[model samples]
Target: MNLFELNQAYRELEERDDLDLETLKDTLDAIEGAREVKLDSLASWIEKNKMQIDWVTEKVKDLQAKKASLTNLNKSLQGYMTQSLDDAGIKELQTKNHILKPRNYKASVVVDSLDDLPEEFKQTKTEVTADKKELYKVLKDGQEVPGVHLKPNRGTVIK
Candidate 1:
């Protein structure tokens, strides 16, 4: 029987005063054993999924590293081609299937040091955040915080 049905049967057995001692004990033991088996099965399923997640996480990291390397290589190749074209004094080259030309990009400001930046050129940002650690300490000591309260949570740990 499933865990829920087994639990119901066990409860029903408790309310019955007509069963003999031996029969009552045996029935409860059987229900308990069934529940144990169901729990073990569920825990095994959780463990299997966790293993798959770890494997996929590692694969994703490897793929990201490979992509970054390929992107850097592409930038290097483009820079080399641009340099070659400029050295050859060619404004544009027309091939059988493609036309390659150097184009000017819009000018961008480069910052070498933040310390040297003028006050007018710098931007200030302000952020507000909750201090959960301090909140926890205050709440545990029977203090009150407006619009905030400690919440109780439960989690299962499998080992």
Candidate 2:
């Protein structure tokens, strides 16, 4: 059934006193051919595995590039937001935060991008994304866009 069994059987037949030299030579050739086929199969399997590994490596590189791109974009956006928020009352529009009598409001730097959005923004996306209810736009009132909370609420007071 297996190579060893087949080899053992072949050997037993070859040791028969009447066995001819031609027959022995033919059997040895056949066994060598079988070994070649097995080796070819192993080579093919290694080639396929190598291809798979190469493909996965390229995929990992592409993902890393995408991550780097996003990081660069976030750094750019954050720097812009900080400068904009600082000069908002005179240059850019201002973000409005309201503290009801019992609550004191504080305005902190926040972003709603792919990576750095707050847990509150991620959880209540419907409230944050609606047109009139954005989470982080500078306002005119300083305009309060519904329920969005900004940090450092005490910017240049609106009069």
For all candidates, the clash counts are 0, 9
lDDT of 2 by residue, 1-159 (tens): 577765565556535667577975565556543665544434554566678899999999999999999999998987776565555543344347632122224977655474676566565333434453333455534766656655665532211
lDDT of 2: 0.59
Candidate 2 deviant stretches above 4 angstroms? 1-33, 89-159
Write down the TM-score of every candidate: 0.70, 0.35
Candidate 1, which segments miss by more than 4 Å at Cα? 1-33
Residue 31 lDDT in candidate 2: 57
